[model samples]
Target: MGCGRPFDEVIAIAPLQRCHVMLSWCYLLLSATMTIECLDLSECQAALGMESGAIAAQDILASSSFDEASVGPQYARIRTDVAGGAWCPSTQIDQTRYEYLQVNLHRVHVITCVETQGRHGGGHGKEYPTFYMLEYWRPGRTEWQRYKGHHQNVLLKANFDTNTAVKITLDTPIVASKVRFVPFSEHLRTTCMRVELYGCEHKEGLLAYSMPSGEFYAGHLFDDRSYDGSRNSSGFLTGGLGQLMDGRTGGEFALGNGIVSDAANAEQWVGWTKPLVEFYFLFDDIRNFTALSLHVMDSSNSIKEAAVSFSLDGRHFSHTLVEYFRYENSSVAPGPDWLSIRIPKQCGRFVLVNIRNTGKLLLISEVRFESGDAYDVEIVTDGPFVGRISSPSFEYVWLITGLLGCCFLCALLVTIIAIRQRQRKVTSPSYTGLKSTPQAEHIAVDLKTGQMKVIRDTELWLPFLNAKANSTNVYMFDSDKCAVSKILEAPANVSSVQPAESASTTPLIPLKSSSSEEDSHCLSRKELFFENMRSEYDNPSLHYAASDVRIVPLSKAER
Candidate 1:
């Protein structure tokens, strides 16, 4: 801060002047290193919507909303307090693990910092998040991953009061298409928050890369532990990218930084033993190539030489450059090297790095693609850059639209069918068809007249009832015998009568009352005899007979 001045002399300066000097000194450091709290923000300061109205309303989402029309996720914006005073959670986060405000960037970008504010009800709101954690998702990621820089899960501090914004610059920025802010607190209270993301577009367009499997050494695995890409049967990383792009570069192994146990060294370096190693990087699309910087542990020149190739497709790569950087060092421990290999006006979607082995051991730490365009957006290697950020496709829109239309038509058809069925049910033939009975014709029935007419005019009804009862065995009483004995009864008079021959005159028989009209409707004498035998013949011995008839044998005419 001083031109090599003594402490006694420095103290002699005025206190106000000293503060001014200190502020200037700090500003210079911030401008020079672009570092704060040991974090390199990369000076990529572009507002990702929230306060700038670029994110849009539909892009914001929440676990819940206090009032969707008023306190919704869209209301969450840094430095402003409108629409129900920031975005308050529907419920207090008391003794809860998660409740979040989410934003979909629609595409991936390097998110270097996040600024936050509480419910600034024009300085009336007390609701603000005390602490929060971030989770993000990007291309090539199957699920959301929580960001932990240097593998340490840390919470970002948030605003304590309303209105005033507090920006939390990440030591390790995040590259994602979507991000979630999960608020937390030690005390029980409702929390509302507004936020903004600061960074630039990830123009490198590097999506994923395939490489040989890492090698093991000296009881330690010199592997990319963070490489989330797929592994093949042959132990190669078939696809995906990890630590190689995360801004946190592997430092001097002898310095003992980013190391695990006593040998964090092995964990950060991507090592291979093959004499000729090949690396394939896939970009989301074609991009112009300017220069590529690589951080490698080549103090011993274990990696002798390398070649660069650019290709429109994965196959038929066109060679760009090859150089031999091999050298022999007699030092006890070989150190790391940084190589900036410039591409001569090349452009392609695929980049191939062919590294030749010199000492049977090769280790690489980091890879960065630099551009000369004004879109010098910082690609925070410390953040997740698993795969290239892909632009949205129009085909997906049409497909979704077609699906929705089909669903709507199906629902309409179902509704129409349901409605018609209901109408049919309400006015069906079962309820309002024929009024006449199918079982019998209607007959005018005056109770007394109907009874007298049935009794006087119809004798078949009684016979039918008797026959039905006999056939159905409906009346056996208690005895288990056939009705034949009851059906036939012997007359009281058994004396035989002389048979009459020739054209026989009608036989005369006495009947009860031939005076009333009922006499004409009554059963004839023969029928009375038969009906009496069938129904009233309960006893065989006791019999009362007014007349008797004897059976005669069938005889031929006059014989």
Candidate 2:
């Protein structure tokens, strides 16, 4: 028998070179002849040990510069290989935290899946650990943030036989120029075989979706979740407290053709050529307002610019030029359009708006009015001030002034008349004394052929004695005290004596008595004298005497 060699000595084979294939086969035959069991380390120890050394070596190699002599040969000799055993480490994997890949994400899409080949025990035991995790970072960002890979719950099993795929969605839909992926767990450490991205070239009038469709809801003016007052519907084309065309009441505007489409049918055409509805607003007080904004939607259910106009008076409108926007414009259409007009001051009562078509569609589900500071400072200040002045207060002022003026004028006229009456009373003529005890003084004269008689009663004539008379034929006496002493021959036409005083007093006296036939003759004589006085005083063409005899007083003796 051949002498048996020690196990350590037999297993201590020399490292093989390029020509060691034949030597390795001879060594295996010698080990089989020894009749010993071929034992291997547990899977956990095997994987951990292999990965530790490989990871360290790879870190060093990856840190080295890619000089032509060193990395050139390695890169050319790189080969594709499948993982073996429970775990396999990727030779080309990058472990740098800041590393990223630049890609043209224009119309591009990428999908990823993860699968576990086998389970590793807990704390080095043979058990699968719950190790589902994901992380991502953008180009400009420095550190990766945690992210949910998909809506589905993550599942782990002790003995995983099938693959589990996790889908990730981009937070923003963008044409990304670059992207970075950070793995959450070591199980997904395999090298990325390929990346797929999907998108379309920029086009005009291309619609991503219909705004009026059920997928897109309208936005609200005040409430973040609601459009208008309705929670179930989408937002309107315009918004505000006075959004309605005819004041506070709102009107109807069609949003789209009432059709729905999906991503498969994207890039479709949908839009409104004309305004479906218009509104007119009149701000009674321009001071209360500050800014105006509109929320609109496109065929893609995106907001777009809507034409707007404002006015001081309702008749004349000034188109407001839009300056700012909240969404990005697509090459296919004119804008990511929404209209917002800032008012620097209040526009008194008249704000007129015309909602021209949103570039994409005609459907206007809702509108909103956001209160703002007035744009026009002058209008804000002057409008209310001028209106108040023209209101009831101004009218009241005018009325009060008018009434005061009338009262003043009436008072002035009364004052003037009173003054004139006082002056006349002060300058009026006066009369003076008569005999103290005398009762009556009487006189008579013959009455033949119209001779006149004179009787005096001093008491009766006292009041008129001082009055001036112009004619000598006139005489005065008091009828209450004077009496005729004798009866003179009656005139030919004289009638019976008529009472001097009667109960039925009359201002005019007849010259003729009723008792005599010749009374008409007496009347004729009296009429002649009356006519003479009338001719002197009543004629427009003649100048009358300064002092007439009828206005003068006569002495009692002449009576």
Candidate 3:
């Protein structure tokens, strides 16, 4: 401690020596603190949990399987579910290019790179793909598109031999739910593969966009050349994401693979001749929007203002927040978003951006958003997915049961009515082959107290007419008295003749008749007083169980 201090003079500078020793301790402590702070785990983060088997077995799939017991799609896990050491197709070889191994990430993710390997059945399996192509699909889409980098190459270099995992980082990150790996070779050989996807959860939440088409000025086509959407008959591009959301800011230069293709190019920007442009964005998931960032480039400086709004459904929108672009600071991150515009505080899945250009031409490069999946407070009646199931509430169950019961009873009543009408039609005199003129009604017979006689008005009818009418009512009388008179016809007003005493002669009635009524007014109100009363026989359409009547003459053998 006294290596550089004088013996006698040390007493005078003792405080300074103690101060210098304390400062040395502080320096060492500071250095140690700085070292601890610099050690962060994010810097050395490599793979996204594939080699460690964090992905589920069910999430991985393949086009075909060589053997289900060993090499099926579920066994396609990176390093864990190696049933036969890897996934191999049913046809292992020499000619086809249709086989592919697929992985469903379950949700949209920001994919940064892809890692692939081959089946390593110890030393026996020496097969591997030299090159492979990637195809990816997102939600709300039907087709799987082949991925192309800035240079527009599809085939990616894989591995020279089995067991060596080849890693390739993408120049343009993919945001999708499913990605498939298609293996390829120049000549012919059996192809099989095991693969892993690397990425983080998607943050942008955008699914698609619909916007007005870019313009064609002079000899140049100032269009969204890299846009993957279709143009409508009205010259609008819709239902696909494109260069505006590709994370590239467009200006006077065109760049491909880090090389300048043109110095005065504006291909990344979608331009229009109109003074205003409308953009509708569809998100992959619901979000709480905070602000928006629009990157606009106009060499003529024609742009004036912009505004934004949001919607829970695509049809309804919130109030548009006006041109507050100049109010907020323009110093934003170079990529994704450039000029920030604060939007209203709301939660939704759709966004509308309106840019008002004060000049004749408009150019827009990119549109990036500021949003989050976690809302401060929200209540959703429906989810991101929908399905149908049997209702659980008994309140609705009772209502449905009541309706069905009413329908069944109504149907039973209708059936009974139809049957009664059909029986009446079959029993009618007209249906039994009897003919009577409109003015000539059928004959009738009546009996009472062992005495029977022809109806007073029907006495003029022919003998056959009496027999036929009697046959229709023969059940009203006994068989002993059913014999017809020897006279071919009956004379009118023949009340002097007496009836046979052997006949029971009780009058038939369809139903019991009440001896009394509560009020004669009830009958008069319904027109049932005396002769006004209606009976089943008065209506030919009515059906009633009736017995046939038979006639007999008064003569005996003694005569």
Candidate 4:
């Protein structure tokens, strides 16, 4: 457990709560403190009770081989074929010298026991050492120490017979990797034997430990009926202790295996080994576990009372987790057997459980330590592209709806205004085409008879005035007194004809040079043209005028 590391280099056990609890140990602090530095021994080849140790035991040394001439068959030889015998010393050598076989485990281990086998003969023939002793060497130690018995005392020699196997069960497991087997008495000069070592692997806590860390140790006893807990020297949660947190309910104590308490005398409830024993658990740092539970069988030996406590540092445990009380009384005839503690919301990494064994061997089928709070784990789906808008919420929906409503309202108002303007244009009156002037006058003239007429109702001529002007003249053809106008030029021989007598009675008006006025009365053009022509064409006068008689005035005829 001595790690050769510097003091300043500290390995973080875990960040407060992330570490997992592998087992509960009574003396973990003591072992942690002894580890001067912990190398990554995960790759280390040696450990307690390793099944592969026999093959890894390569560095073999011996006092003398039976055949010094050839060291191949006389020294350590691994048995490959049953027909061929392994390394054996010469029988002819003197029996006075001490003989020993040594192997290097290549790494440290906490050895609990060892098993040795005699040389097997094909038939009834076999060979074994008469007496032998087991010894081991620590990593940095030059001296060897004899492996002790179950009572923590060294024996001179453990006696054994030939052809029979001898098993040495150690009382206290030792911490070493290299071991030697010395045969004091053998039937032959060289002993033919094989050895096996069993113990826990000396390692860092799989998480944290250093050369200068803390150390602690506690011995545990499991119910002999179910599991061989005593055989587990590593103090790991194996057998019934391992199944304590399996999350099973009812019959927990007697589920796969049962936990039996140590035997105790009557009237003395507490015993050194059992009946009343305390168990300790350590976490990497301060933690608040939810609950602790104990399951007992419905029997006389079921646990009647228990208590719990907590500690931050392994030393001080002042907080009480639970007080003692009888969980299952003897009066109850086979009912549910379970005891639970609320844990009092305490924050600590160390927990102490004190259990009572009721006279008879207590059988606990289950134990539980709920580590954390109940929670739901949700796995969010992440897409490759980010910054995408999330689904619209209720407020977003309302805001969008309000904006759309405002837009629709504005459009409706514009449509109403446009309809009102169109209606005003349709309802109001409009005047178009020609307007009458006081100076302008219209005279209707007849072309055939050279007669001129005048009329009053200006509204009656609205159709003609509103009509678009074109080459074809619009006039009334029937005698309906419809108003119409035409200009007639006089005939070419008008000078040979004479004017009517009424035409002479109408005095001819003189013409102005720049006049656009319609003539009120028309006379023969030849007489007027001859009189007006100061200069003339040779044939006739070029200036021709129309002659028409004007109708009588409306004001003088009808009243």
What clash count goes with each model?
8, 58, 7, 31
In model 3, residue pairs whose N, Cα or C atoms come closer than 3 Å (at least 3 residues apart or on different chains), thus clashing, are: 93-190, 473-548, 473-549, 474-548, 474-549, 474-550, 475-548
Task: Give per-residue CA lDDT, model 1, range 1-559, as digits (tens).
Answer: 1212221232233222223353344333322311111113465777988998988989999999888987899899887668687898888875465788999987878788888888878767888888888888776555666666445555778886877788876655676789999888887888988899998766556656677788875555677666545565677674455677766677665423433444665567778878898787766654555556677775345666667777655655663453435445434255665566644435456678887887565778777775322222232223221112122246766878899999999999999999999998888655122122222111111111111011122242233123332211111110111010111112222333333343111111121212332322222223222112222322222112212322222122322
Among the numbered candidates, top TM-score falls to 3
lDDT: which is higher, 2 or 4? 4
For candidate 3, the per-residue lDDT at 391 reads: 30
- Ranking of all predicted structures according to lDDT, beginning with the best and ending with the worst: 1, 3, 4, 2
TM-score of each: 0.50, 0.21, 0.50, 0.31
Top of the candidates by lDDT: 1
Which structure is stronger by lDDT: 2 or 3? 3
Whole-model lDDT per candidate: 0.57, 0.27, 0.55, 0.40
Candidate 3 backbone overlaps, count: 7
Query: Which stretches in model 3 have alpha-carbon errors above 4 Å?
Result: 1-48, 74-83, 92-96, 150-153, 213-229, 233-235, 248-274, 298-302, 324-337, 358-365, 377-559
Better of 1 and 3 by lDDT: 1
After superposition on all C-alphas, the RMSD of every candidate to the true structure, in Å, is: 26.5, 34.6, 26.0, 25.8
Residue 87, candidate 1: alpha-carbon lDDT: 90
| Residue range 30-115, candidate 4, lDDT tens digits | 12212111222233323232234353434766665554443322223322213323334444223454556776766766555666
lDDT of 2: 0.27
